[model samples]
Target chain A: MKNKFIYLNNEEKISSNQNKPFVYLDNGATTKVDEETANIIKNNIVEEYGNPSSIYEFGLNSFHNIENVRNLIKKKINAEKEDNLIFNSGATESNNFAIFGMAELGLKNNKKKLITTKIEHGSIKAPSKQLQKKGFEIVYLNVDSEGFIDFDQLEKELDENVFLVSIIHANHEVGTIQNIEKIGKLCRKKNVFFHIDAAQSFTKVEIDVKKQNIDLLSLNSHKIHGPKGIGALYVRKGIDLKKIIFGGPQENNLRSGTENIPGIIGFGKATEIGFDKNEEKVKEMKELRDYFIEKVLEIPNSHLNGSKDDKRLCNNINITFDFIEGEALLMYLNMKGIYISTGSACSSRSLEPSDILISMGRSYEQAHGSVRFTLSKYTTKEELEYTFTCLKESVENLRKLSPLTPK
Target chain B: MTLEYTKKVIEHFTNPKNVGEIDNPSGHAIEGSPACGDMVNIDIKVDDKGIIEDVKFKSYGCASNIATASVATELAKGKTIEQAKNINWKDVEKELEGLPQVKVHCSVLAVNTLKKAIENYEETIGIKKEAKSIEEKAYDELKNVVNPNTGNMLVDDKLIKEVSIKEKKIILKIDLSDEDLYKNNINDEIKEHLEHLFDVIEIIFIK
Candidate 1:
């Protein structure tokens, strides 16, 4: 059967006879929404235009749609309870709430320590810094060169005064999936709060809140091919989280704002579709990823940043090319109609080395020279072949100009 | 045809001249900003006639910095104490082809180090009178000048530690640790301030 999963732009198909558009390799930055999910969003915007907060029948209809979507996500992730899911702007906001809310809770209980790792995204690091300034003792757990957190060090750092352990499910830069289930079990045994920023791995991996013992989980819709500007935080029942933003009573008086009904519906649909397609997609992506890795290894001085065999996300591949700047290589690839991200998209312009890689014991130079390639369900073997060709050419061209490379 | 820099200047950058230290030279001058990571040290030898016969520099920075040091040495070689004082950054930049706009200050570090070497050379020759004259000249011009960025007088701004005029080029060596001067727009401010005083100005930040 013809693969219906191949990505094609409707606008391009209608306007031109081009066989292929740009090969987008920057799925880690943001994936294009599936056609079905896109249709749901489009239909909501076009027809269901009423605000969910309004008192009219149309508003009621939108409100019911919001609840249905929430329920769907609740069922998909198997959250402890339906009310535990609280919607926010995106994963950044959800992360902020998780960190700040936990800190505030700790403050109320006279606990002043927060435990986290050095490799977390800036969304976690920035808030952790804020908490440190606010008089909370912050302990940053270190990671090894392969981006694996030292669980022994974590155990030593955990104490009675420690408030929360916030970590990313899988690193966005190097694609190292942390043992959240093991970490969660430890946290539960210690009676400590655990929060996972699952933005990169939420839909890609199976996450059972109870199985993992996750107290709080943050997820972004955009990462799963849902609408942007919509995400949710799962705050376990009986956990008292202090509200960061105070306004009109909504979201059980936790997050107060006019609900984004259409985006929420799209997020819900994406979540449902993601869980359904995950098993088959995972098998396919792993095959493609392994093949891509095999081809990439042929290039000299190119190295994988994370573990080759483990519980890594099937779609993520982070490789570092010695003697070449990642940003320059990315720009060259973009000119050739291949899109990929170098390090965190949020901090790409800052020229700062990846914190995740640094914590993993990589030098600043190695961290700066790394590029991430994240695939989606729609990614095909043909695209992978084209990507390898473009990458080989780009690396050679970049090395020619690099001062560090010898002739 | 690209640019005709002195062969010595390009040679020093490619295979630098007088690399490392001199096992306790008569005098040592170390200068550069940590923010910029540009540093230079110069050592000199003087003969009985109070003429500078030898000059060597150990520089840590970009390509322009090494070229500047090599050119400064060529300009200072065999020059009497009186003649070396007139060497300026413009002369160095001109001698070493032309530095990129962002790296013009590399030339300044070379000029600054040469001035420090001269000071040490004069002291070594026991010419106390000439040393005072050189100090007086540097002190006079730098005293009234203000760092344009901070709007504070150069002497009062505390960023500048020493200033010398050599060959119509004024070299101002600054201390980067002086918070009020090197923070934010201060570099641009100081550059603009120095432009109005002399036809060619060079600044060396000594952290």
Candidate 2:
């Protein structure tokens, strides 16, 4: 059967004769929006163009659509009680709001310490560092070689001074899923606010805020086959987060800006689809992941970077070759049309090796030679075969020039 | 010739030449920079005319680095000191087809090793000259100077193999057996009392 996602690429072709199959394995960066979600975004912008803030009949209809999407997302995540869901540009802005806003609110009380992991994405790490420069003491919990945090150290570090604990639910590099439930419980006991950067993990992994004892969560729509430039921050009921941007009191006074109505609606619909299809998708992805992992191991000196167990995200398979540069491998594979990521796409330009791998006790050399292959439900066996073929040749070509390799 | 090397540097890297080391050699020098893993040691046998008749090298580093070393050795063999010293990195890269921007440093390592080997040879020559001058001076000064009790000059009593001079101090390398010395008055006798005898100063024990 032809892949629906590949078929979407055909529809993307401007002319009928220009269609070509492009296997996209970089879904961890961002996914191609599904047809339904894309249609919803197009219709909302082109036809339903009423300003949500306006009180006229047409404006009221648009406002209702916005509320409907908000409520739909609220129900999808099982956010009990009337929790405030504020829409933002993306997870970066949402993360900024959660950390900086919370820090701002807690400043008067002298609760200034922020606890987070060493392997968090730049969106979380950047704002946390900014907070640190502004007099907030930041404690970074170290992750093990498998990219899981040391809970013993975390328990010791959590104390009265910590105002917040912000961590990514799943690592973007190695796909190690953090134990958010235990972390959430620990935060609750310490009375410290816990914020999850669920950009990569939100729709892929199941999350229940109340069950996990989560206080705040940041999510991005583009990561889950929805429109870009739209994301939400789930602020638990009774939590007081100060506004960072000022102008108008929209999003229940939590976020003050003109709401991105169409993007939010698309985000909500995408979340709904994800929640419904996550089970089947996870099963299919696990099968494809196992196949890819098994085949990749046949290559000499090839090893998986993350956990082999179910604790890892089913879609992610980060591999390290003994004597190859990640950039060279990525470029060679790209020439073959097998798209993949060397690390987080945002930080790929730095070429400084994976911070997540370094945190996991991988040597700088190992981290530099790492490549991340994240799969989606749309990925097929044929794509994996083609990727494997290209990868074998690329690694061989790169290793031929490496001085570290033995004859 | 143009100063810039040709693109052949990359080709040499892709197809490296003369990879391993030779068995035995007359002179050998190993140099490494801990900052980077660039290491090269060359062993050579030069003819009376100062031509490098035979050269062998072992390099542990990047491809460009190793290739540069191999190419540098090949280029240095038939050339005189003047020509070898004038050898530029561009020539090494020209020997190889081309090199990527990052791997250009490998070629630099090769060039640096070539310069180091020449410096090592010159340093060896200086050491030899200094040693010969020091021996001549010591032989003239200590010819008749004797141990007070044994009535023998310290140099006449033993064979010296090596001598090193630093600042105002002289260190003599000698091979001696304990049975060659008589126990009685060994410390207070000849060598001990010679301190007051002449300008030939400080004797040391060696094995």
Candidate 3:
């Protein structure tokens, strides 16, 4: 059921169920594009096909439309007028630009240290390692058993040599929402640049760059019902980041490739529409997520990862079942047509367990058994019930067949 | 669309053949770890001519573990002890078409358990190695038989009160209620299985 494209005229509406019936719970991995966003992308491809770089009437119109979309995104995030949004392929590129680019800028200023947490996404973690190999000291702040960042450790690591402190606003795997406002204020006080990877939290949570005092923020479209391959990195007026890719002066010479016009327009439309229903969407997500968790925990020897008392992304639920492997569980769920993810989608293929869980002091057994269920605005109660039934049956069968008895 | 596993692998995995164990098995071995999500146990009954009369396996893992073990038992059954010992994991992988690169260890688990069971068989009748006392052999075999419902061995369940072997006859005193879910056919299955393992005239299962 992958890579199946449908061509629809303006009169014909796009439906998600056209291809097949599936209970998709991997919204944290990526969300399904809404009808409005799909229509915008289609119209952009069919009617507004002009290259914005060219000097013509259509090109000028394209350029104007792009600016309008950018403005719409700017308004959605409630950023200051001085802030600039640099579009990129997605959060990975934005994170690279934030981490690697800042590391280079830090090196120029004789600040050879970068600060981050062990629970940051691989996009940030990998770039941090790259910087580490280049002789820059990368300090990974520890998280408690509940996946909460140690503010004391952050305070101890902050020094004049520390140029950038990059943290994720909402972790992709465990769904723990960090205290970015406090972290931002601390970074501002320490005169260190703060970058927040808001890929999972952008549209789900309220974020104001000025109010949060965040210097650099990474936002992606696909995680918010927008089209894929389009994201934005919000940079404050005073902070200057070196370009990772060299090209023409597009995106203020930071990201210099031809813009993804259709994706950008779809992102704008998705954001605008998503914002219109933000409160209602959050309520629905919380209800579904809570109901699912309550039922899932009723299974014996199942435990939730990360903090339950603190704030988490409304749609994310991560749980670990003792004596069962996450990959096996995922396969069983996949066979049942209930598509969910295990651990981080990026690292699930690897034999290694989730680093995020390991960093939170969970044992390898716990980390290996972790499964993530991320609901979306489109997810319904019927889907949740179906997923629950399939999950229970799969777990019972797997455990019965498993050699590892519960301790 | 089909998954990466072969049709044979999927078939064996989904509806595994000869699952569970042989009571008072002539040869038995447990290998791999459920922590790493791959564990298999093989039990074999050897005939007087040193040929594998019957083989069964129980595995706790993904499709690869279950399929590899199922196919391994099929390859070893009815083969001579020497021939079964020579059946390597690569042969099992080949018989199942193939396993994923990461799941190659599952084939290894199947082959190791099969060989270990053959080794245990050889030691039981003083064929190729030193033989343990009959009581020790019976204890080891019974200790390895895991309960499919609870995943614990019978010894861990504290169900067996007495185990005695006289000549070629083995008697087991299992403490359980008739209303137990595993009660129906419990005595008949154990009697049939142990009779093959010891080459005995009969087995008495006393409750």
Candidate 4:
């Protein structure tokens, strides 16, 4: 189960010496698209230029290419029925489509509430707020410091007025996995539509649509090392959603646009390759995440931001260092050709701290002081060691300049 | 996305100048606030000639914050007290070539902290200065604090709806409870500006 993605050895790397070695640990943001995935995308753009809707041999092949990928994802998730999935722009569109579709059903069924969580992606958070403006009661389920939502709260909120409940499968910031199976069952018991945004957990976490009773699941490429701008939504059968996109009636009238054949096929191949050795990949990343977290917490006044148990994603580590800020640390590491990211308010144009951290009961200061290091399967021990050395020095330097540091 | 900071800004951030405190300095002032995710303490040594001999800063902020402080310290070092007070955020931004537009505010904090440190030094050495009205003092503190929402002063931007000075306490009713990223920094800067004179400060944000 060794990874098919190979890293260049020391001898091979010697030719690219002199320049600082690049070590990127922001896989949670977006990964370096897989080599084979990129090649397929390039080939499709050059060779498979047939329109999916055209009635020709090339177009038929193009249409089949799109379906093949869709079927591949369907089988991966153990979806209940065929023709319930439709290709979309990406995770954002898929999520938006799911929410809007459910909103339509809710309005007709006399349901007045939509239940979601504070830790959802901005797509879900924004739309839920918009629904509130549109007279739908929006309930944001509360999560603990480790990001597990209170089931009691979910149960209490799942009244008959609730039509849809959407949650993230795995958090983008903390990488904490939710109990989707349990949530899906609870939603089923209440006759509510259960939706999950699984962009971060598609191949990384196991998802079973039928067994879990997930009615609407949002998925995408890019985060799984595939080409960007192509994603899909799985709408369970028996759920009648009115079509919102009014165009040339593509995607069985679910989505109406010319298909991105290259991205579709590229995503298909990437997800297929990602499944290869994924269990082993997860094991390696989990071990590395644990070891790295343990080593980092050795620094004075450093804290691990989330739990490090089985519920944590295999590749995520978020930490807050006392007396120093995360953006400064991010830049310091960036100076050494090592790139990581911070969830701090200073990290973005909007000066507010990370919502996920705040939702988990973190103080504004703690959220500002936090940095996230997300590893990929291709991350090497040597690269991590080098990162640790730089990180130690950077922390020491920043702390020395911090008045909060004890003399 | 990063701010596309100039090489000078990166260099200054990587190796900050005059870091930490100066032992028994003639003047010291801490700007920004920890609860707000940024605080800067500037310490300076002024000789009998009223020239700053040494300047240092302790910063808990982002890269631009540190870099701005470093460049401000570099600009303040060896300058006369009056000349140092004249140093502005624009001077710091110019010294670093340019900062990202949004990050230009950090330079404002740096320059203000330096000026406040110089003012403390002037007060310590028996330099008589006129005591301005509390309203004027509030205006002085918030002069450079801009709101990106309006590209104007925070007060002018309606971020702070009301400001009242009651006894020894200054109360500010700000309406940025929606987690305006700048809320903490603005709160800290106001406290930094007026906390020297006012013992009790309570900032309440209205919905």
Most accurate candidate by TM-score:
4
Report the lDDT tens digits of candidate 4 across residue range A60-114.
8899898889888888889864538888888998888888888988899998888
> Per lDDT, what order, best first?
4, 3, 1, 2
Docking level of model 4: acceptable
**Model 4: lDDT of residue A175:** 89
| lDDT of model 4 at position B153 | 59
Tens digit per residue, CA lDDT, model 4, B118-177: 888888888858989987777777765764433445654566788888777888887766
The Cα error of candidate 4 at residue A255, in Å, is: 1.0
- Structural RMSD, model 3: 14.4
Instruction: Give the docking tier of candidate 1.
Output: incorrect
Candidate 2 CAPRI assessment class: incorrect
What TM value does model 4 have?
0.89
For candidate 1, lDDT tens digit of each residue in B1-207? 011233344445545454444555655566543222345677776666868767677654444556677678778878887898899777876776555433455675578777776766666657555335544555533443333333344554565777777766777777764464324334443544345456677767667
Comparing 2 with 4 on DockQ, the higher-scoring candidate is: 4
RMSD of each: 12.2, 17.7, 14.4, 6.1
lDDT for A341 in candidate 3 is: 79
Error of 4 at A86 (Å): 1.6
Off by over 4 Å in 4: A1-17, A347-353, B128-134, B148-207
Inter-residue clash pairs, candidate 1: A144-A360, A145-A360, B32-B205, B85-B166, B86-B166, B86-B167, B87-B166, B87-B167, B149-B189
Error of 3 at B119 (Å): 3.2
As for candidate 4, its clashing pairs are A351-B181, A352-B181
TM-score for each of the candidates: 0.68, 0.69, 0.81, 0.89
- Please identify which of the two predictions, 2 or 3, would achieve the higher TM-score against the true structure: 3
True contacts kept of each: 0.00, 0.01, 0.17, 0.52
Q: Candidate 2 on A63-146: residue-level lDDT in tens?
A: 898888888877777897589888889999999999898898778668898889898888888998898888889989998888
